[model samples]
Target: NCGTWFLGRLQTERDVARVLDGLEGAASAAGNALDRSEIGTLLAGLRSRVFLMNNAHEEGHLLFHTRWAMSYLRGPLTRKQIKLLSPSAPEASGDAPKPAKSAVPTSKSSRPVVPAGIEEVFFSSEPGTYRPYLAADVTLHYLRASHGLDSWEKHVILAPLEEEAPWASAELLDRGDVDFSDDAPGVAEFVAPPAGSVGTARFRSYGKQIRTHLYQARPMSLWRCKSLKLQSKPGESKSEFASRVQLAAREERDAGVEKLRARFAKRIQSMEERRRRAEARVDREKSQYEQQKLQTGISMGATVLGAIFGRGGFGRATTAARGAGRVAREREDVQRAEEELRDIEEAIQALEIEVEEEARAYLAEREDKAAELEEVVVRPRKSDIAVMGLKLAWKPD
Candidate 1:
C-alpha cells in the first residue's frame, strides 16, 4: 500500500535518477571529446564526493549506477568501453536454454569463487537495452515476513563485465549477503528457504542469473549500481524504501556540499578583498614614490643643465637645446607614471566590485542552504503530518 508519503518519495527518486542520467549522457556524448584537464576536474570532484582515498574499488560500491556511468564517461578511458559490443549483433537470438553454470562456488574446488577485499557495486543501462555497459551479476539473500516486525539478511556478489576495467574478475564478483532487521513501524522480516533447499536458487537469486545471462550475450552501454542499501522494513516496498534512502542520501549529501561550497566561497571572497586592499595600498604608495622620484629627477636635471650651460662649456644654442631635452624627458616620465596610476586605480576598483558581487552571492547561497537544512532537520514529524489533516469545507446554500 502506497502511503501518503509515497508520491513525494517516488518523485524524489525519479528526480535524482534523472539528474544522474543527464550527467551520464553528457559524459558519454563527450566521448573522446573531453580533454585531460576537464576529465581530471570531474574525476577529482567525484573522488572528493564519492570515492575514498587510495580506494578505487570503493567507487563501484559508493555511487549509483547512473552516477558511476557519468563518472566513467568523464574518465580518460570512457570511449574504449562505450563500444563494448558491435552495433550489428544479431537482432534477436532464438530461444535456447543453456546448461546451468555456477557463478561463485561456495565450496571452492579449483573453481572460481567469490574473492576477498571486494565490496559494493553499481551497475546501469538504458531502458529496453539488453546489454548493460556497467554490468555485475550478484547473488544476495534476504527475508520477508507479513505478520509482524521482521529482519532481512542479504548477500550480493557483483562483477563488472567491462573488458577494459582493471577489476574484471568475474570470480570475485560472484557472491555476498546482508544481515538486516526491520523493527520500525509498518515493517517486517524477509525470510527465504535455506540454500540447496526446496525452491530454485534462480528465484532465490532475485533474477540475478537471468540478468547475468543477458549481460553476457549482449554487452550493455549503461550504468547501474549492484550494491544497494537495503535498510527497508518488510512492510515498506523495496521501491519505496529505495526512494526514501536515495532522497535522504541526496538531501544529506547536497546539503553538506553546499555548506562546504559556501564556506569556501566566503573564504575566497575574504582573501580577494584583502588582496584588493593590499593592491590598492601598494598602488597608492607606488604613485607617491614615482611622483617624488620624478620631481627630484627633474630638479636635479634642471640644476645640471643650468650648471653645464652656465660654465660656458657650450654655446647658447646648445644650452637651450639641452634644457629643452631634459624638460621633455621629465614631462614624458610624469605622463607615464600618471598612466600607470590610472591603470592601478582601475584594477583596484574592478577587484572591489568583484569582491562585493561574490560576497552577495555567497551570503544568499548560505542562507538558502541553512533554510533547507533546517527544513529537513526541524520540520514537523510524521505524527504531525498525520494528525494535521487538511480540512475540506463547502459553502452552505
Candidate 2:
C-alpha cells in the first residue's frame, strides 16, 4: 500500500504525457519529424512546471507556462533555429485569433454608455454644476503614499466647462474662470479647485499620469515649443523670458553657420560627382550609337556597288540601301537622345550649382554674423585689457 501511494503522482504525469502525445501526433500528420527523446523532454518540462495549490476555498494542482518559462527551459529561439516538430505554443506561431470589432451605435438617441470596468465621475467648484468623463481604474495607484487620484477637471475640458451647452444639467456659478498669466508660477493655480473641494485635491499618482497626458497632447508646433521655455523664477514674466531665449537661440544659430557652409560644400561635391557619372554613361551610349551608324553606312556602300553591277542584284541592292538609310536615321536619333540626356544633365547641374551657391552665401553671411557676435558677446579677459592699458600708457599718447 505504501509503494502504491507514489502511483497517484503517475496520473498527473500521464495527463501531461497525453498532451505531448497529441502534439506529437499533429506534428507527424503535418510531416514534421520529432524524435522520441524530444517528446519526453517536452513532457518532463510541462510536468516540472506544475504546482499544487492549497487554499481555504479549494485545493488542487495547476500547470502554467509562459514565454519566459519556455525560453528559460529550452534556451532562446533564434532566426537560425527551425522547429522540425513543435508543440502548439502561442509564441511559436503568432496565429492567435483576434477579438471581433464591436459595432458602434448609430442612433443619436442612444444613451452614453461607459465601457465596463471604467467609471464616470463628476466634480465641480461651483454648485449645481457637474462635469462627467470616463476614467479607467482610477484607484489603481492610490494605495501608494506618493500616489493619489487626480481630478480630471484640471486637464480635460469637460463639456460643462465649455461656453455653451444647453443640455447640461449642472451649471457653475462663476463664469469668470481665472487665467494663469504666462511667465508666471502657476496659471493653473487660478483654475485650481476650491480649497477642500474634491476637484482641488488629487491622488498624487493618478495626477501625475493625467498631467503627463495633458502635456503630451498640448499643441506642439515649433512656435509653441519655443514659447514653452519660460523663466525659472515664478515672479518673472513669460514674455521677458521669451525675448531672452529668442536672442540666445539667434546667437547660437549664427555661430553654427560654419558647419552649414561645410555641409553645402560637401553636397555640391557629391552632386558634381553624380553629374560626371551620368554624363559618362550618356557618352558611352552615344559611342555605341555611332558604331551602329558606321556599320549601317558600310552596308549601304555594298548595296550601291551591287546596284551598279546590274543583273539580278539591283532589286536586292535597292532594298539594302533603304534598310541602311533607316539604320543611319536611327543612329542619328540615338545621337539626339544622347544630346537630350546631356541637356537634362546640364540643367540639373545648373540647378544644383545654384542651390549650393545660395546655401554657401547664406552660411557665409551667418558666419560673418557669428564672428560679429563673438566679438560683441564674448567679453575679453581682464588680463588682455590690462596689457592694452599698459601699452597705451607707454606710448606717446
Candidate 3:
C-alpha cells in the first residue's frame, strides 16, 4: 500500500528519500528494523518509473522529473479493456461503434500531422494538472519527420514547471519512434471522458477526441503561448544562439544610451554657450566699474583741491557728484550680470544631471527586457494531436 501511494504521488527523488525516511522512522517506532537492501530496491524501482531531465533554456538550468503512468508498470491492458478504451470500440451491448455525424471523415485522416523541426510548444494550463493520452502513431510520425537522414534520433524536451525549478529537474521523453508505439514499454492508455454536457455531446457526435483530450482536464486560469527559435539560423547551436542574443541585447542597450546622450548633447552645448556669454558679460561689467571708480577718485581729488584753493569750486564739486553717481550705476550693473551668470551655471548643471538619470533609466529598462528574451529556433506547424499530454500551439516570436 505504501509503495502504491508513493508511486502515485511521489514526483521527485527528494520525495522518494523523504518517504524512505518516514518508513524507517515508523519501523523504528514499532520496534522493527528496515533492511538497506530493500530500501535500495525500492529506490531502483522508483528511478525506473520517474524520468529526470535537464531544462536547458535562458532561465537557470535545473533537474525535474515526471512519473510514468502507473499503468505503464502494471503491463498492457487486456484486449477487453483495450476495446473498451479504444475510440472505435463497440458499445456495452455489443452494438457497433457509433459513426461520427460530421462530414469530415475518420479521426486518423482528419488529425493534422505533427510539424517537422524543433518547436517550442506551450500549454494554456498549468503543469501537472492534466495528463492526456495521445495516439502513439501521431507522435511517432512527428519524430520520424523531424529526424534528419544522418541523425535519426530525437527527444521531446519537457521544460520544468514554472514553480519546479532549483529544487528539481525537467522531464525528457525519448522520442525514438519504435519505443513509443501502442505496445511500447512505457506507453499506456486510460479512459477519460469529456467534462461538461456540451463537451460530451460534441465528443459523441463528432468523434472529436482532440477537443475532449484538452478541455476535459483544463484549469480555471487560461495562459497565453509564445514561441522562440532555438537556433536563429543554420549552423548555430542553441547555446551559441543564446550567447549571441545576450551580446545583441547588450549592444542594443549601449546604442540606446548613446542615442539618448546624442539627443541631449545639442541642448547641453547650447546651455554651456549661454553660460560662457553670461560670464563674459560679468567680466566686462567689472572692468567698467573699476574704470568708473578711478574717474570718481580723480574728480573728487580735483574738487577737494579746488575747494581748498577756492579755484573753480562749484564746477569741481558738481563734477565730483556726477562721477560718484556713475560709479554707483556701474556697480549695480556688475551685480546684475553676476547674478545672471550664476543662474545660467545652475541651469546647466541641473540639465546635465537629468540626462545622466534618464540614461540610467533607459539602460535598466533594456536590461529587464533582455532578461525576458529567450533564444528559440524553428516554428513547428500546429497540429490537433497532443503528444504526451501537451497540445503545442506555435506562436511566432
Candidate 4:
C-alpha cells in the first residue's frame, strides 16, 4: 500500500503539467511574444511570489493572474511606468480596440458647452501622480496597502455621490463599506480559508464580493473637474434659471448693436437727400442764365438804350442774383454731406474698437487659469460595469 503513493503523486504532477501547457501558450500568444526560455523564467517568477494568506486558505494556482500580476508582485511603485492594464500588447492587425475619446482641454477653463451651455467646469490641481494618469498609483498606494486584490473580485457599482433621491430605500454605500479591513475579502483569503469553510471559502470570506460591489465609485477622467451647479429653490432640483438668465443677456446685447447700426443708416440717408435737393436748384439757376444769354444776343447799342430805361438791363442782373443764391446753398449742402459721412465713419470705428477691447478683457480673465487647463482632460467617465450608466439607485417615485 505504501508503494502505491507514487500513483497518487503521479496524478498531481500530471495536473501541474496541464497548467504549465496552458501558461506557455498564453504567454506566447501575447504580441510581445515570449520565447521558450522566457516562458521558463515566467514560471519561475510566478512560483517565487510570496503568498500572504491568513490561516483560512491555501489553494493556489500556478498562473492564477494576468501579466500585470507579475508587475504587481515586483516591488516599489514607479509613476513613470504607469499605463492602463492590458493582458496583451496592442495587435498590429487592427483587432485591438482604441482608447476611449477624451475631452480636449485648451487654454480656457470656463469652457463654453456650445458657446452657450454648461456641463463640466475645471479649476487647477497640484501636480504629480494620480488615478488614470498614474496606473500604479491605485495598486501601489491603494491596493498594495494590504495587497488585497483577489482573482475573483466583486463589483456593485452605483452612481456618484449626490443628493438623496426621493424614492431611495437605502443610503448610498460609503468608502467605509468597501474599505479594506480584516473582515473585507482579500487575495490572502483566497490563498487560505478558515475551517468550516462553506462553498468556495474565498468568495464568501467575510462577504468581500458583496462589499466590493457596494462602495464602487467611478473615477473621473479629469485631474481637476468640478461639477457645474446652479442655485435651486427649496423644491426644484432641475431648474435652469441661471442659464436662462445668461441667454437673455446675450440676446439683449446683440439686439442693441443692431439698433445702433440702423440709426446710423437713417442719419446718412437724410444728409444725402439734402445734398440732392441743393444740386437740383443749382442746375435750374444755370439753365435760366443760358436762356438770358440767348435772348440778349441782339446788341450792346440796344443794351445801352435799355440801360437808360432800367427794365431790359435789369433782367441779366436778376439772373445773376438767383445764381449767386444757388451757389451759396450748394456750398452749405456739400459741407453737411461731408459732416454726416464723417459721423458715420466715426461711429463704425468706435464700434470696432469696443468689440476688440471686450475680447481682450475676456481672454485676460482666462489667462491665469491656462497653466492648469493644458495638462488635463475632462471626458464623461462612468463605471464601465454600470452599462446603462448610473441610474436612479432608489426606486423611482
Candidate 5:
C-alpha cells in the first residue's frame, strides 16, 4: 500500500533489501539534483519531530527506531574515485573509471602523486547529490495481537551511520530487525507534490520498492544570481572596479525578474477572478432551482381530477415537468461553468510555464554577459619566486 504512515510488522528478508538498495540507488542517480536549501529546511523539521519522539521515552534506545532503521543513515559515495593504481592514464575532463592495472609513470609531473595504498576520492560539494550520503528514508512500525488500541511501538530513525563503520567506533542509535514482526502492515506513506517546484523529492518504501512521484523545478534560473561589472572608471582600483561591476549585474538581474513578474501578475489575477465568478454563477443558479425541485420530487402530489382514487395525475405530471426542467438547466449551467473553469486553468498554467521559461532565458543571458566581464589572471607578472614575492608588497621603501 502507499501513503501509509504505519509500516507494520515486516518479517521478510526481501523487505529489508528492498528498503536499503532502493534508497542507495536513488541517492546515486539523483546526484546534485535536489534543492539543498529547501531540503535543509525540511530535514530540520524532521529533526525536530525526531527530537520530540526521543524525548517521549526515558532510556534504553534514545531514538525511536527499528533494526532496519540503519538504512536511513549515511548514503554510499556516488562520486567516482581517482585510483592510485590504474593501468591507463586518468582523463583530463570528467571523472573516469579506474583501470584494471596501474599505468607506468613516464615522467615526473607537477601534480602530487599519492603513495601505494590510499585512494583519492573526488567528493562532490553539491548538495543533495552525494552531499548527505543518505539518499532517502523509510518509516517502519511493528505490532502484535497482544497490543491494545493505539498503543503500539512506533519506530522512526532520525539518521543513519556509515555502513561498514566499526560497531565500537560509534554509539549505535538504532534498533529492531528489518522486518520486525510477521503481522506488520505491508505499506508506507509519503508526501509527493506535483512537478514544477523549486526542487524534487524522491523516496522508496521498505515493504517494496515504490517508484516515488518526483516534483520537477519550474526551470527558473533566478537562483543563479551574481553581480557583474565590465569596465572601471578612471583612477579606480582593480578591486573597486570589480565590486562596481558586480553591483550593476545584481541590480540588473533583480530589475529584470521584477519586471517580468509584474508583466504577468495582472493577467494571472484577472484569469483567476473570471474563473471564480463563472463557478459562483453556476452555484447560484443551481441553489435557486435544484432545492425546490428536490423537495417536490420527494412529496406526494395533491389530489386533482382523480381525487376519489386518491391519485392526482395532473399534479404528478406538473411535478415531473418542473423536476426535469431543473435537472436540464442545472446540467447545462454546470457543464458551461466547468468548461470555462478548465479553460481559465489551462490559460493560467500556460502563462506560468511561459514565465518560468522566460525567467530562465533572461538569467542565462545575464550570466553569459557576466562571464564576459570577468578576467582571471592566474599567471603571475614574473615566473621567478623572488620576483613574484616582490610584486606582493606595497612596492617602495
Candidate 6:
C-alpha cells in the first residue's frame, strides 16, 4: 500500500492540503472497511511523514544552492511559516499545552533564552547562521583552484551581506559547530573567531553582526581577503610574519633617514668650517685695519708737527701721503674680508634650508616605499582568504 502511494512535490500549504484531501477521500471510498479511529490514525501518520519528508527535501535543496537561495530569500523564513511547514516545529498558539516552568525566573527581555543545563554562547556580532550545503565542497574547490590558492590549508571568507541581501543584517555568517583544522581536506570551515580574540578586530571593523537564521551562506561581494604564503622561516604564524615584515620596513625606513641625515651633516659641517675660516679672516683684517689706522694717525700727527715747526716740509708731506694711502688700503682689505664672511654665512643658511627640503622629500619617498613593501611582503589572515574564496564562488564560469 505504501509502494502504491504517489509522491509529488509539495511546495505550498495548499498542495499539502490537497494531498491530504485525496488520501481522506480514498479512505472514505473503503465503505465499512476501516473504522473512524483507524482512518484518523492512518491520516495522521501519513500527514506527519509527508511533512517531514518535504521539510528534509527542501532543506537539502536550499543547502545545495546556499548562496543563491539566500540571495533569493533575502531573509530567513518567518517562525510562523516554518512552523506551518515543519511538522516537528513546537506549537506557539495558546491552545497548545504549555511546558512545565523551570525554577529560573523568566524575563520578558528580547534576548534569547537558553535552556537549563546548556552553556550560553555569546557572539560579538549577531551570529548569522546558515546550514552548510553539499555544493560547498565543490564551490570551495573551484575557488581554490581558480585563485591558485593551493598553498593555504584553510580559509575564512568575509563578504558584505548588506549588498546581496539588503534586508539581512550586517553580520558574520555563523558556521555552527564546524571545526576547522589544517589537516582537514576541505578548503575551509565556516567558523567565527571567538569574541575578544586576536583577529576579531578585523571582523568588527566591518560593523556587521550575524542575525539568528535557519539558512545562511557567504555573500557575493568580497569585503576582504586573507591568506597565508610560503613562510620565510619554519613555524611562522601569519600574524608573526606580518609583524616581522612591518618591523623590517620600519627598520629600513629608519636606516635610510639616518643615512640621509649623516650625509647632509657632513656637507653642513664642511660649510660651517668654511664659515669659521671666513670669520677668522674677518677678525684678522679688522685688527690689521685698526693698527694701520692708529699708525696713520701717529704719522699724520708727526707730519703736522714737523711742518708747523719747519723741520722738513717735503719729508712731512711725503709721510702724510704714505699714511693716507696705507689707511685706505687697510680699509679696502677689511671691507673685502667682511663681504667674504657675509657670503659664507648666506651659503651656510642656504645649505641648512636645502637639508630640510631634502629630508622632507626623503621621508615622502620612504612612505611610498613602505606601502609598496607591505604589498610585496605582507599576507592576509585566514579569514581574509576565505572572504576572497566566497567572492570567487559567485563569479560566473
Q: Write the per-residue lDDT of candidate 2 for residues 1-397, one digit (tens) a residue.
A: 1111010112344564565465456555555554434333223322322322212122212233223334345776765564644535656446857775332312212222221222223332222322222122211111111112111222212222212321142221221342221131211112212111112112233344333433433221111122223222222244554555557656655555555556667766766776676667667767776776677677667766766876556666676667667666666766766776677677667766776676567656544543231111122222211100000000000
Displacement of residue 281 (Cα, Å) in model 3 is 0.6
Better of 1 and 4 by lDDT: 1
Better of 1 and 5 by lDDT: 5
Candidate 6: regions farther than 4 A off: 1-250, 371-397
Model 4: lDDT equals 0.32
* Per-residue C-alpha lDDT of model 4 across residues 232-329, encoded as one tens digit per residue: 22222222433433444445445655655565666556655655655565565556555544444434445556688886777655555565565566
Kindly give the stretch of ten consecutive residues in candidate 4 with the minimal lDDT sum.
Answer: 132-141
What order do you get sorting by TM-score, best first? 6, 3, 5, 2, 4, 1
* Cα RMSD for candidates in order: 35.9, 39.0, 24.3, 27.0, 40.0, 19.9
- lDDT of all predictions, in order shown? 0.35, 0.37, 0.47, 0.32, 0.38, 0.43
Off by over 4 Å in 1: 1-235, 262-269, 311-397
Return the lDDT, model 3, position 178: 22
What is candidate 3's CA lDDT for residue 207?
29
Q: CA lDDT of 23 in candidate 6?
A: 50
Regions of candidate 3 where Cα sits further than 4 Å from its true position: 1-231, 234-239, 375-397
Better of 1 and 2 by lDDT: 2
Count of residue pairs whose backbone atoms collide, per candidate: 38, 7, 11, 9, 21, 14
Judged by lDDT, which candidate is best?
Answer: 3
Ranking by lDDT: 3, 6, 5, 2, 1, 4
- How far out, in Å, is residue 194 in model 3? 36
- Taking all chains together, the TM-score of candidate 5 against the true structure is 0.33
Native-structure RMSD, model 5: 40.0
